[model samples]
Target: MKINSTVLLTLILLILMLGAGSLSAFLGFTLGSSALKGVSTPDGRPTTKFASNKATNAQQAGLTLLKEEEILKIVKARIEGKTKAAKSEKLDEDDEETKSSKQKPEEKPQEVVEEKLQPGFPVTAENQGVTLSVQSVRYSGGDLLLKVKMQNKGADSVRFLYSFLDVTDDKGRTLSASTEGLPAELPTNGPAFSGTVSIPTALLDDVNKISLSLTDYPAQKLKLDVSNIPVARVAGLL
Candidate 1:
């Protein structure tokens, strides 16, 4: 018997659809079983090997991430520690500098000492019975010292006292020494009289000269120019 063409076509389509579905199901089962076998252990038993591998991989990744985070934390802490130490050190240095800047310095006092004059000339004066001489001029502090020698060369004793001691400048301003302030005293019949005469350095200058005039000897008033002396130099007295 001859079949209708449309019905025959419909039957062929249904068979093809059924065969395609069966083939797809067979392929899916085969692939799924093959994957399962690849992940299984040697024993023919159900296994979670694939799942265990996936979990292990994920755990290893987590550990790596955790280690990296710990390293970052350590590095950050070190950097912060160094920064803090640097800041603290700078602060200490600044404090020390400030203290040094605020502190005051100590003061020292000036002391004056004595010094002798040099390159002096000898000046001599003689009378009928007494003779006087000045050999050197010395200096100490603010005073000038004169080294004088005297002698009684006559048959009788004679007393010698301070006569006139004066310093003169170009302006003729005179500063004289008094008898009460004289540094030496001559006795009667004294063979030799040796002493000093202190004159204020303020009363004289480098350009000034001193003149010792004795207008009064033992008991008589007689003017005599004993000494007219200049300073050691034109600049300083000694």
Candidate 2:
């Protein structure tokens, strides 16, 4: 069927109007989208300056944390240094104490001396029989104790009838003495006979000399020196 021109024109116009409406709707949607994108949040307006301010705030916070960390490190270093200095000071103090202790006075050692004695009296019709010797003298209990060893040098045995031991102080005071009752006898050509004689404590302080003599024995003359004995620090009676 052949279409009328008016109807065709009317159809064309309606189509054009629809197209224009579509175009206007699409442009409106595009403009609305662009405007919405350009708008800020409901709280306030938006700008590059605001974004820059947020970034600056973030950077400043980070810088503040860094500065705080640096300050903390410095404080920690200072505390460690103080602890080390304290320890060093303590060590120096101990060293000084040790040095001072080493400078104190020291004690001296005690000395000991020995003496020997020989008989000087006649023993037989021709010659002397034996000799008496004092080997050592020691001071103990505020007194001096003499150790005497006698030897019989004669060919025959000799018996000591009576003997005596004596010790004198620096003032000629008799410190110690043994009578004949305490005589010690020895056999001929045998080992020496040993005996101990003790002096009184009262005379020990002034004792500077010692004498050992035999009155009735075959060998009578005998003597010894014992002046280097250490003085007793404590009283003998106590």
Candidate 3:
């Protein structure tokens, strides 16, 4: 009985060990399959969370690339616009210059007429209590300058307006004259007063002789006249 019981116990222990090993192998295979299912989709694709994250990342990258392209395009457009504007401005300036050049005409300088002066001077005239004398002559700045002196010889005072002095060329044309360094009134028995008379040489271009006449203003009582003053041509001067 003891031997039979020992054999039966050994067989029982061997069956239990086989069954436990089979169950352990099956559990390991099932757990491994479950772990694979957790990491991957049923069609062998990645998990939904991982795929969604990857797709979002790709979309963001594409958006970034598009934004970069858009920014580059905007910058290029602005640069090209500025370049075109500058070119347009330059063309407008060139057009304006061309129009201005075509519109205006050139001007010529006026001709200056010159004359010659002779040597006859120191002409004198007397009227009432006044004596008028042309003392000297000179040429300056396209004008003929005459130095003159006046004396009040009588007892009474004498008043004169040099503006009323009349000058005429040989051709009977009146000439303009300006005077300086002369007094409006000459006292009684006063010393001689010196002055200058300037006449534009342009008016004397064809004249050879001139006449001068003077009289007291308002009264017109005193009269002095000198005529036939010759001005001959001089060589080496115009």
Candidate 4:
């Protein structure tokens, strides 16, 4: 059968339309699978895989930077705290030392001793019709010369034979004895007999208790009682 030109054109158009629709449906299925495969991620991100990865890397870098900053801040704080503590400790030590230096030392007290005098009823003696009273007794010495002054207050002349000075301590213990030939005799009218006694410095630590006793020649039995003599001490004597 012969077809008109208008009908032929219509038929061709319909065929072309149908073929295009079928081709479109096939292409949509094939491309949809490829697009779905390309868009899917294991972690569930959809359209922006490359951008998401870049964002994740950036976030990790930012976290690392923040951790580093935190650590540095902690270290700085620790250093500053240690420095302040050391400064405070040094100040406290210095203050304690200053207080100790300003403190004063303690002082010792002084001691006082009173002097005692002898009792009354002085000792008396008579020999060869003459009586001699022993008066004040005194001591004098500097270097090697130690002398005792004995005043005779009696009216008659008496011979002081073998007179010796006995030096003793406070406890009545004899420390030293004077050598012989101290003073031969005492003239009645002359100033009371003065005798030079030799005593080493080691023997006389305390010279306050030294006694001077006299013995007469004719009798040689009676001892002159002349204790409690006022003894003096001289320094730098060897």
Name the best candidate (by TM-score).
3
Go through the candidates in order and give each one's C-alpha lDDT. Answer: 0.66, 0.59, 0.82, 0.56
Best candidate (score: lDDT): 3
The candidate with the higher lDDT, 2 or 3, is 3
3 or 4: which has the higher lDDT?
3
Those runs of model 1 whose alpha carbons end farther than 4 Å from true positions after fitting are 1-120, 163-171, 178-189, 221-223, 232-237
What shift in Å separates residue 175 of candidate 2 from its native position after superposition?
3.8
Total clashing pairs for each candidate? 0, 1, 0, 0
Off by over 4 Å in 2: 1-129, 161-163, 179-183, 218-238
Model 3: per-residue Cα lDDT at residue 169: 87
What lDDT does candidate 4 reach at residue 19? 100
Ranking, TM-score, top scorer first? 3, 1, 2, 4
| Residue-by-residue lDDT tens digits, candidate 4, 1-238 | 3568889999999999999999999999999998888575566555568888889998888863448889999999999999999999999999999888788565667667643322321233444333333332323352223344444445554555443434555568775555433345555555644445555556555565445455666755535544554444534221
Error in Å for residue 229 of model 3: 2.5
| Runs off by more than 4 Å, candidate 4 | 1-146, 151-155, 163-165, 179-182, 206-208, 221-223, 229-238
Clashing pairs in 4: none
